[model samples]
Target: MPIRTEIVSQDRIVYQGDADMVVLPGIDGVMGILPNHSPVLTALQYGIITVRLKGEEYYFTVAGGFVEVQPDQVTVLADAAENVAEIDVARAEAAKTRAEEMLKEGIPSDQDRYLMIQAALRRSTLRIDAVRRYQQGRRSRG
Candidate 1:
Protein backbone atom coordinates (compact mmCIF):
# COMPACT_ATOMS: atom_id res chain seq x y z
CA MET A 1 0.00 0.00 0.00
CA PRO A 2 1.18 3.50 -0.79
CA ILE A 3 1.62 6.07 1.95
CA ARG A 4 -0.05 9.44 1.77
CA THR A 5 2.44 12.25 2.16
CA GLU A 6 2.21 15.98 2.42
CA ILE A 7 4.99 18.55 2.71
CA VAL A 8 3.90 21.95 3.89
CA SER A 9 5.94 25.09 4.26
CA GLN A 10 4.82 28.29 5.95
CA ASP A 11 3.44 29.82 2.78
CA ARG A 12 1.95 26.80 1.04
CA ILE A 13 1.77 23.10 0.57
CA VAL A 14 4.85 22.04 -1.25
CA TYR A 15 3.63 18.54 -2.11
CA GLN A 16 0.67 16.32 -1.46
CA GLY A 17 0.41 12.86 -2.90
CA ASP A 18 0.79 9.16 -2.34
CA ALA A 19 4.23 7.68 -2.30
CA ASP A 20 5.60 4.18 -2.10
CA MET A 21 7.98 5.30 0.64
CA VAL A 22 9.16 8.57 2.07
CA VAL A 23 12.61 9.37 3.40
CA LEU A 24 13.06 12.15 5.91
CA PRO A 25 16.03 13.90 7.45
CA GLY A 26 15.22 13.22 11.02
CA ILE A 27 17.25 14.88 13.78
CA ASP A 28 18.61 11.51 14.81
CA GLY A 29 19.44 10.57 11.25
CA VAL A 30 17.59 9.69 8.10
CA MET A 31 14.31 7.90 8.64
CA GLY A 32 12.39 5.98 6.02
CA ILE A 33 8.64 5.65 6.33
CA LEU A 34 6.58 3.03 4.56
CA PRO A 35 2.98 2.10 4.66
CA ASN A 36 1.93 0.68 8.02
CA HIS A 37 5.03 2.02 9.72
CA SER A 38 4.87 2.77 13.41
CA PRO A 39 3.79 6.22 14.47
CA VAL A 40 6.41 8.87 15.03
CA LEU A 41 6.78 12.58 15.57
CA THR A 42 10.25 13.93 15.06
CA ALA A 43 12.22 17.07 14.35
CA LEU A 44 13.90 17.32 10.98
CA GLN A 45 17.26 18.79 10.16
CA TYR A 46 18.42 20.72 7.15
CA GLY A 47 18.66 18.17 4.37
CA ILE A 48 16.80 16.40 1.62
CA ILE A 49 13.46 14.62 1.69
CA THR A 50 12.74 11.92 -0.85
CA VAL A 51 9.49 10.36 -1.95
CA ARG A 52 9.38 7.36 -4.17
CA LEU A 53 6.48 5.92 -6.15
CA LYS A 54 6.82 3.00 -8.48
CA GLY A 55 10.28 3.47 -9.96
CA GLU A 56 10.14 7.24 -9.95
CA GLU A 57 11.52 9.44 -7.21
CA TYR A 58 11.01 13.03 -6.15
CA TYR A 59 13.49 15.08 -4.14
CA PHE A 60 12.91 18.09 -1.95
CA THR A 61 15.18 20.33 0.10
CA VAL A 62 13.96 21.10 3.58
CA ALA A 63 15.70 23.65 5.77
CA GLY A 64 14.20 22.61 9.05
CA GLY A 65 10.92 21.12 10.17
CA PHE A 66 8.97 18.50 11.96
CA VAL A 67 7.37 15.36 10.59
CA GLU A 68 4.50 13.30 11.84
CA VAL A 69 4.25 9.72 10.74
CA GLN A 70 1.20 7.60 11.15
CA PRO A 71 0.50 4.12 9.89
CA ASP A 72 -0.52 5.31 6.45
CA GLN A 73 0.38 8.94 6.24
CA VAL A 74 3.35 11.27 6.64
CA THR A 75 3.07 14.99 7.18
CA VAL A 76 5.95 17.43 7.04
CA LEU A 77 5.65 20.90 8.46
CA ALA A 78 8.69 22.73 7.23
CA ASP A 79 10.30 26.10 7.75
CA ALA A 80 11.19 26.09 4.07
CA ALA A 81 10.88 23.39 1.43
CA GLU A 82 11.13 23.15 -2.32
CA ASN A 83 11.41 20.54 -5.04
CA VAL A 84 14.91 19.99 -6.32
CA ALA A 85 13.77 20.55 -9.87
CA GLU A 86 12.27 23.87 -8.88
CA ILE A 87 15.38 25.14 -7.11
CA ASP A 88 16.80 28.27 -8.64
CA VAL A 89 20.52 27.53 -8.84
CA ALA A 90 21.41 31.09 -9.63
CA ARG A 91 19.46 32.42 -6.71
CA ALA A 92 20.89 29.86 -4.35
CA GLU A 93 24.36 30.69 -5.52
CA ALA A 94 23.73 34.35 -4.97
CA ALA A 95 22.43 33.75 -1.48
CA LYS A 96 25.40 31.61 -0.64
CA THR A 97 27.76 34.30 -1.83
CA ARG A 98 25.96 36.94 0.16
CA ALA A 99 26.02 34.82 3.26
CA GLU A 100 29.70 34.12 2.86
CA GLU A 101 30.41 37.81 2.50
CA MET A 102 28.44 38.60 5.59
CA LEU A 103 30.25 35.96 7.56
CA LYS A 104 33.60 37.28 6.43
CA GLU A 105 32.76 40.68 7.82
CA GLY A 106 32.56 39.06 11.26
CA ILE A 107 29.65 37.87 13.34
CA PRO A 108 26.92 40.37 14.02
CA SER A 109 26.42 41.69 17.57
CA ASP A 110 22.95 40.18 17.49
CA GLN A 111 23.38 36.45 17.92
CA ASP A 112 19.95 35.78 16.50
CA ARG A 113 20.75 37.55 13.27
CA TYR A 114 23.99 35.64 12.98
CA LEU A 115 22.17 32.38 13.48
CA MET A 116 19.59 33.29 10.88
CA ILE A 117 22.33 34.05 8.39
CA GLN A 118 23.97 30.77 9.14
CA ALA A 119 20.71 28.96 8.60
CA ALA A 120 20.19 30.78 5.34
CA LEU A 121 23.67 29.81 4.22
CA ARG A 122 22.99 26.20 5.05
CA ARG A 123 19.66 26.23 3.24
CA SER A 124 21.09 27.77 0.11
CA THR A 125 23.93 25.30 0.09
CA LEU A 126 21.52 22.43 0.50
CA ARG A 127 19.38 23.69 -2.38
CA ILE A 128 22.37 24.05 -4.69
CA ASP A 129 23.66 20.60 -3.81
CA ALA A 130 20.25 18.98 -4.21
CA VAL A 131 19.89 20.47 -7.67
CA ARG A 132 23.36 19.34 -8.61
CA ARG A 133 22.86 15.84 -7.33
CA TYR A 134 19.28 15.12 -8.35
CA GLN A 135 18.56 17.43 -11.25
CA GLN A 136 21.85 16.47 -12.91
CA GLY A 137 20.83 12.81 -13.00
CA ARG A 138 23.11 11.73 -10.20
CA ARG A 139 20.18 10.09 -8.48
CA SER A 140 21.32 7.90 -5.66
CA ARG A 141 18.63 6.68 -3.31
CA GLY A 142 18.09 9.28 -0.59
Candidate 2:
Protein backbone atom coordinates (compact mmCIF):
# COMPACT_ATOMS: atom_id res chain seq x y z
CA MET A 1 0.00 0.00 0.00
CA PRO A 2 1.19 3.48 -0.87
CA ILE A 3 1.32 6.22 1.74
CA ARG A 4 -0.52 9.43 1.01
CA THR A 5 1.87 12.37 1.18
CA GLU A 6 0.95 16.02 1.16
CA ILE A 7 3.32 19.00 1.30
CA VAL A 8 1.83 22.39 1.97
CA SER A 9 3.19 25.90 2.23
CA GLN A 10 1.35 28.87 3.71
CA ASP A 11 -0.37 29.72 0.45
CA ARG A 12 -1.12 26.36 -1.20
CA ILE A 13 -0.36 22.68 -1.44
CA VAL A 14 3.02 22.13 -3.01
CA TYR A 15 2.45 18.45 -3.63
CA GLN A 16 -0.14 15.79 -2.84
CA GLY A 17 0.20 12.23 -3.97
CA ASP A 18 0.77 8.64 -2.99
CA ALA A 19 4.31 7.49 -2.56
CA ASP A 20 5.98 4.23 -1.66
CA MET A 21 8.53 6.08 0.45
CA VAL A 22 9.08 9.58 1.74
CA VAL A 23 12.26 11.03 3.20
CA LEU A 24 12.22 14.23 5.19
CA PRO A 25 14.96 16.45 6.55
CA GLY A 26 14.27 16.41 10.26
CA ILE A 27 15.86 18.96 12.55
CA ASP A 28 18.07 16.30 14.05
CA GLY A 29 18.68 14.40 10.86
CA VAL A 30 16.95 12.69 7.94
CA MET A 31 13.90 10.52 8.52
CA GLY A 32 12.41 7.98 6.17
CA ILE A 33 8.76 7.01 6.20
CA LEU A 34 7.05 4.10 4.55
CA PRO A 35 3.58 2.64 4.62
CA ASN A 36 2.36 1.84 8.12
CA HIS A 37 5.07 3.99 9.65
CA SER A 38 4.54 4.88 13.30
CA PRO A 39 2.87 8.14 14.12
CA VAL A 40 5.21 11.00 14.98
CA LEU A 41 5.56 14.73 14.57
CA THR A 42 8.90 16.45 14.16
CA ALA A 43 10.38 19.77 13.18
CA LEU A 44 12.03 19.88 9.78
CA GLN A 45 15.23 21.64 8.77
CA TYR A 46 16.09 23.57 5.63
CA GLY A 47 16.85 20.79 3.17
CA ILE A 48 15.31 18.33 0.75
CA ILE A 49 12.21 16.16 0.79
CA THR A 50 12.30 13.16 -1.49
CA VAL A 51 9.28 11.12 -2.52
CA ARG A 52 9.53 7.82 -4.27
CA LEU A 53 6.59 6.38 -6.17
CA LYS A 54 6.90 3.16 -8.03
CA GLY A 55 10.48 3.35 -9.27
CA GLU A 56 10.74 7.06 -9.78
CA GLU A 57 11.85 9.80 -7.41
CA TYR A 58 10.66 13.35 -6.92
CA TYR A 59 12.61 16.06 -5.12
CA PHE A 60 11.42 19.18 -3.37
CA THR A 61 13.41 21.84 -1.51
CA VAL A 62 11.89 22.87 1.80
CA ALA A 63 12.97 25.77 3.98
CA GLY A 64 12.10 24.57 7.45
CA GLY A 65 8.73 23.08 8.46
CA PHE A 66 7.07 20.40 10.47
CA VAL A 67 6.23 16.89 9.38
CA GLU A 68 3.66 14.48 10.71
CA VAL A 69 3.61 10.81 9.92
CA GLN A 70 0.75 8.46 10.58
CA PRO A 71 0.04 4.93 9.53
CA ASP A 72 -1.61 5.94 6.32
CA GLN A 73 -0.40 9.43 5.57
CA VAL A 74 2.46 11.89 5.85
CA THR A 75 2.00 15.65 5.90
CA VAL A 76 4.57 18.41 5.64
CA LEU A 77 3.66 21.97 6.58
CA ALA A 78 6.56 23.99 5.26
CA ASP A 79 7.50 27.63 5.60
CA ALA A 80 8.41 27.47 1.93
CA ALA A 81 8.65 24.62 -0.57
CA GLU A 82 9.43 24.30 -4.25
CA ASN A 83 9.77 21.40 -6.59
CA VAL A 84 13.21 21.08 -8.09
CA ALA A 85 11.83 21.14 -11.60
CA GLU A 86 9.93 24.36 -10.94
CA ILE A 87 12.98 26.13 -9.48
CA ASP A 88 14.65 28.80 -11.59
CA VAL A 89 18.34 28.03 -11.57
CA ALA A 90 19.43 31.57 -12.30
CA ARG A 91 17.23 33.03 -9.62
CA ALA A 92 18.44 30.54 -7.06
CA GLU A 93 22.00 31.31 -7.98
CA ALA A 94 21.41 34.99 -7.53
CA ALA A 95 19.86 34.45 -4.13
CA LYS A 96 22.77 32.29 -3.10
CA THR A 97 25.22 34.93 -4.16
CA ARG A 98 23.40 37.63 -2.25
CA ALA A 99 23.20 35.48 0.86
CA GLU A 100 26.91 34.71 0.75
CA GLU A 101 27.71 38.39 0.44
CA MET A 102 25.47 39.27 3.40
CA LEU A 103 27.06 36.61 5.54
CA LYS A 104 30.56 37.61 4.59
CA GLU A 105 30.04 41.33 5.20
CA GLY A 106 29.17 40.89 8.87
CA ILE A 107 26.70 39.30 11.19
CA PRO A 108 23.72 41.35 12.25
CA SER A 109 23.48 42.61 15.84
CA ASP A 110 19.90 41.39 16.10
CA GLN A 111 20.07 37.67 16.84
CA ASP A 112 16.74 36.94 15.18
CA ARG A 113 17.68 38.77 12.02
CA TYR A 114 21.03 37.04 11.91
CA LEU A 115 19.39 33.68 12.29
CA MET A 116 16.92 34.51 9.55
CA ILE A 117 19.74 35.44 7.21
CA GLN A 118 21.53 32.21 7.99
CA ALA A 119 18.36 30.30 7.22
CA ALA A 120 18.04 32.10 3.93
CA LEU A 121 21.58 31.15 3.05
CA ARG A 122 20.90 27.54 3.89
CA ARG A 123 17.70 27.48 1.84
CA SER A 124 19.33 29.02 -1.20
CA THR A 125 22.25 26.63 -1.00
CA LEU A 126 19.92 23.65 -0.71
CA ARG A 127 17.89 24.84 -3.71
CA ILE A 128 21.00 25.14 -5.83
CA ASP A 129 22.18 21.66 -4.82
CA ALA A 130 18.75 20.18 -5.46
CA VAL A 131 18.63 21.71 -8.91
CA ARG A 132 22.05 20.36 -9.70
CA ARG A 133 21.06 16.88 -8.63
CA TYR A 134 17.84 17.05 -10.64
CA GLN A 135 19.69 18.12 -13.74
CA GLN A 136 22.25 15.38 -13.27
CA GLY A 137 19.54 12.77 -12.84
CA ARG A 138 17.82 13.94 -16.01
CA ARG A 139 21.06 13.87 -17.95
CA SER A 140 21.79 10.35 -16.77
CA ARG A 141 18.35 9.18 -17.85
CA GLY A 142 18.36 11.03 -21.14
In model 2, which range of ten residues has the least summed lDDT? Answer: 133-142
| lDDT scores of the candidates, listed in order | 0.90, 0.86
Give the number of the best model, judged by lDDT: 1
Model 1 lDDT per residue over 30-90, tens place:
9999999999999999999999989888898898889999999999999999888787899
> Any idea what lDDT model 2 has?
0.86
- List the candidate 2 regions with Cα displacement exceeding 4 Å: 138-142
Model 1's TM-score against the true structure: 0.94
State which candidate has the highest TM-score: 1
lDDT of 2 by residue, 9-114 (tens): 8888888989899999999999999999999999998888888888888888898889999999999999999888778888988888888898898998899988
lDDT of 1 at 74: 98
Error of 2 at 28 (Å): 2.8
